[model samples]
Target: MAGIFIFSEDSALAKQLLTPALELKASLAQPITAITLSESDAEELAKLGADKVVVLTGGTWAEGFAEAIYSQISKAEGSILLVGGTLRGKHVAAYVAAKLNAGMTTDAKALKIANGKLLATRVLYAGLAVCEEEVALPAVATIRARTFLAPAPAPAAGVVETQSAEADSRITISEVIPTGDKGVDITAATKLVAVGRGFRRKEDLKLAEDLAGVLKAELACTRGIAEDEHWLPIERYIGISGQTVKPELYVAAGLSGQVQHMVGCRESKVIVAINTDERAPIFEAADYGIVGDMYEVLPLLTAALRK
Candidate 1:
């Protein structure tokens, strides 16, 4: 049987990866394991249907970590690997696959094990099309974010093992400059309030911010809102080729809800749209929509929510 490995740097990602991996594993009739950086995290991962949790102590590019996992693959003789499509996860998956000389499928929306081999589906042409891929050389696959929800009740107890790997000394990260406000990590937030081009001036963002504060949501922006007018940082953009999110709720203000933008947030459970144009495409995906001037509606909504 193939061993499906889910890689996580933090508990939240573990929360995201484990459930979907477990669901996919059950669907494929494969065994699932989680790999993390800490035992505490491993313990948490086990609750999400992981049959085992392996903890590795090493930073990025630590060849030792890869070597340790390679050793585990040798022992487990597992044929299938699963990883998140995040920058770090994708990078590590590629490196590991190369080191193992395994076939790799990236940004796989779905994957299945058939006839003891891996079959994966990936998007093409900016989601205009999907292509099916078959991996013959013992595959490594990165799962797309927001594709599945976390499983309920967790899985049975799982074993935790601490492992050590050799560190790669070739490159070192000297500093990390995070984007957005010091407190904002929109992609990780449970709720997001995004603004778009229909908003007239940069000063109007205060209204959106107030709504976000009332809703206890993070602030995001469309590509035009962020890049064209500089109303928000480029990092805040949510659309095709940008950060994809599956927030519990997403409230978009003055956004047209273009296909590029909707692709990123389609998995959001509840979408609320506010735009003056009743014909805007955003209303198609919105669970609730309000047609009126954002300047008037935002303050009212924020005040109502605060009450």
Candidate 2:
């Protein structure tokens, strides 16, 4: 029977994908099938709302199961497949799309079924524009983290099944060296303090860090701070090519809010900007603006929040 399928290597993101999958299920009247590498995730998905949970075991790496995942979906004649939008997940999703000869959408912000087609909304041109893509059935799409909240538990849990799948042996495992930088998942942060090029030096970041600490928020940065200056980890960067966030409070400090940067945090519930230049684009996007040096503003804000 044709059904809607969801897959993700990350357990949390897998659950998030269900939000859209459930919506599609409501519109298409198809059963929901969730595929995962973890048995624990299968149980969670089964409880959450998936009509069926297929646990793909025996794969050393999640990406290696792409072929197996495609096989299962093809055998089941799944009408639509939603994959988690992580780097690893994207790789698996693309491979499966190719094997199925299906159209795929990446970083899809929204999804829906209309007139027997899967319509996905996503940003285009370095976040300069928004466009909707309509794909024919047997469609595939990748959704980023925090794009949707996990659906509440279903009235009744779904069935769980297991399938043995071998990992691709083409690439052998070697040493796994950790990057050592322990950075939190900024996309999942409720509040964020994003720093940009406006800071004079890396040491100046301490000011922003102080503010974040007072607000109990995570530290985020523009691409330059992370990539160019190396003041922060790459994972902390927020831009068109970086992490997108929808925090309850977003404080952009010393950052010129270009489209590339704003695109990532524009959906924030409340945006506050502190830039010396009044003409900065960040002010236009922010819900509140303070025209002054972030160096000056951050200290004052932190002091006030601390009291």
Candidate 3:
């Protein structure tokens, strides 16, 4: 049966897409199928309103992951395929889209259905404008995390179809490194408290750290703080030269709000800038601005927010 398909080994991301997938299913009278590695998460997908779950395994992510997915969907009729837009995930989506001759939209912030096709809204020109386009049937799109809230679990469980995929002997995983061993992945953080080069010394990071603890936000930093000053891990860096984050709330302290830094955080739902310089560019882009020294303001904020 023709159905909506979501490709992600990440259960949380799969669950997030369920809300929209179920919405589309209801309107089109189609089913929702989640393709992932077979496990308890497959059963959980059913609770999230998926009608069927395909569990695939037997290869390192790059080795057989893409091949297994393509082998299964190559026979399907008109259907929709959605995936997370992580760097590697982009490779997989691009490969499949090219093979199927399907249109695709990458880094889409929003997705909906209209005229029986997928309509996606994406940021363009460094978040200066929005681009909306309709993708044809048998199309694919890579969705950004935090773009959609995870759907609530449904009472009825869907069926699980286990499929064995042999590893692609031609492809091999060269090596693996643990990213978390470095530091927090700022990209996945919903709330972020980022510091900049305003701190005279790296030791002053404690001020921002305290604020982060109280706010329960991931501690992030500008390129100078992480790269030059070495106050935080490289993974915690956010900028055009670092990582991009779209947190719901971004509390930036001491940052001048340069274009390079703003490009990374322009998608944040709310930006709160705390800086002593009244003319700082950060104030122009922030939803809320405070013209005060972060050293004093952060301490006051921490004391007030402390439990």
TM-score of each: 0.71, 0.90, 0.79
- In the range 97-168, model 3's lDDT, one tens digit per residue, is 887788998877777788977888876665556789789877788876666888887888898888878766
Worst 10 residues of 3 by lDDT: 177-186
Tens-place lDDT digits, model 2, residues 1-307: 4899999998889999999999999899999999999988888899899999999898668888999999988999889999999988999999999998999999998999898999999889878899999989999999988789999999999999998997787977777666624656787799999999998899999999999999999999999999999999988888888888889999999999999998889889999999999999998999999999777788999999999
Candidate 1 lDDT (Cα, 0 to 1): 0.78
Candidate 1's TM-score reads 0.71
Candidate 2 wrong stretches, greater than 4 Å: 177-183, 300-307
* Model 3 misplacement above 4 A: 181-192, 199-201, 204-207, 210-218, 227-230, 239-249, 263-270, 287-307
- Write down the lDDT of every candidate, Cα atoms only: 0.78, 0.91, 0.81
Measured on C-alpha atoms, candidate 3 has an lDDT of 0.81
Per-residue C-alpha lDDT of model 1 across residues 158-233, encoded as one tens digit per residue: 7888776656656676887767667666788999999998788888899998999988898898888877898888
Worst 10 residues of 2 by lDDT: 175-184
- Assess the local accuracy of residue 299 in candidate 1 as a C-alpha lDDT between 0 and 100: 95
